[model samples]
Target: MYIAFALVLLFIGAEGLVRGSSSLALRAGLSRLMVGLTIVAFGTSSPELVVSVEAALSNQGDISVGNVVGSNIFNIAVILGITALVCPIPVHRQVIKVDAPVALGVALLLVLLLFNQTLSRFEGVLLFSGIVAYTWMSFILARREASPASADNEDILAVTQSRHWGMDIAFILAGLAVLVVGSRLLVEHAVALAGSFGISEAVIGLTIVAAGTSMPELATSLVAAFRKQPDIAIGNIVGSNIFNVLGILGVASVISPMEAPGISALDYGVMIMFSVLLIPLLYTGRRLHRVEGGVLLALYFGYLFLLWPE
Candidate 1:
């Protein structure tokens, strides 16, 4: 019952967030794609931030660190893979040149930070600053490159013009609040259930907790894809993966230094592999085709298979 309720809330929260964020972006003179990359992506990533912080506070370093690492992997492989299968997502030039490379850099940075198997408060502050800089750079670039709104953007504006700006802000806040709560319930129940099967904290955090908290991203991206907003669909995943590492982990490590002894180098390697693979897949024809999507799905499932016993 709790899991079912959590799913409902996740769906509703994701719907509200997508509607509110997309409309708000159009009104604010930001492109829908930028909106997806920044606002929608950060908003959807809130659950991850919450989960990791809570785990850090409780001194469960494995869960805290594993959650972000696993969530990033899931965002690229599972979320993007499923979204591409629904509709081949166009690769934004900015993403390939700037955003994806930034994502890879941060993943490498995380590895460096974890060299001592610990994330110090100083390291956390540095990670946090990267997110701030990244967000500022993204906005500056977005405004500088602003063009006339597309038909889709105009249509969204028209639909939302009837409503007030306050309502949009309200929807965003409410959606984020609901998403955090829903993901908490889902993760707690899921961890409990996984414990019954004798799953380790590291595995539960990497797989179940990561997937549970990422439900918002999955729902939002799928909804965006169906709504014919490919930028939002694609941007949301790339942006979320970046935010998952820089934002969520940064905040968690700041709260309490995390020691991730249980998270092996192989886990980090897999995460980097996925991040690296996206570039070539997206660079080819500048679109993620259904066949590429299947490859991603197969890789993701294969990774899961490797994680569990025979």
Candidate 2:
């Protein structure tokens, strides 16, 4: 019952966030892709940042690395896959050429850092610095590309302006409130339930807790797909994954360095594999088809099989 209620709040909160954030972007004459990458991505990623920080401060810090690695794997394989199945999400060429490659590079960098079994304070700063660079780069790129979008973008922008700025601000704040509260409720119960099953902290953080915190991203992307905003849909996943690795991991480490307690290389390899797979899979047709989505989802379950409680 609690799980169901929490999901309801997540869904509601995501709706408001997508609506308000997307409106804000359009009103600003910015591309939906930019809004999806920044606003929606940050909104959804808030849970990861909060949970990881609190856990680090409390000394249960091992979960930080596990949670981040697992969440990134899940985002592309599960969230993006499922959204693709909904409407066969279209991939932008820039994403294939620019965004996906950067995400992959970051993934490789993460693998090397994790090899040491410790994310040091200095490394945390480097990762956090990347966040600043990536955000500004995205803004510059988006503005340059905005003019090429067809008249449809103009129509959407006009519609968004019909909405009062005050209402949009209210929506953003209200959405954030419910999203945070709901994520907390869900994470607390989820960890307890996983513990009852004798699940390891690493596994719980990697699977259940990670998935719970990612509810907003899942909801936001699914909504974007249903609304026929393909750019927003895929952008949310790409953006969230980048945020998960760079922003969330960086801050968590700065607070308390991350180490994957008892986490195996095979597990880390699985995370890295999922990240690498995005490149070719997306490039095949510059689209993620329903069949491919199924393939990705199947791979996610396979990873879970490897982690299933002894």
Instruction: Indicate which candidate wins on TM-score.
Output: 1
Deviating ranges (above 4 Å) for candidate 1: 10-33, 148-162, 165-169
Worst 10 residues of 2 by lDDT: 150-159
lDDT tens digits, residue span 228-278, model 2: 756566666777778888988888788787666556787778877887888
Model 1: lDDT equals 0.80
Give TM per candidate: 0.88, 0.85
List the global CA lDDT of all models.
0.80, 0.75
Encode model 1's per-residue lDDT on 1-310: one tens digit a residue. Answer: 7866876676677667766776777687766646655776787777778778877877778888888999999999999999899988887688889998999999999998998889989899999999999999988877665666434533322334316788788878888788777767766776676678887777878887788778888877677677765656666788888888889888888889989887888889999999999999989998999899999999999989988651
Off by over 4 Å in 2: 1-33, 150-173
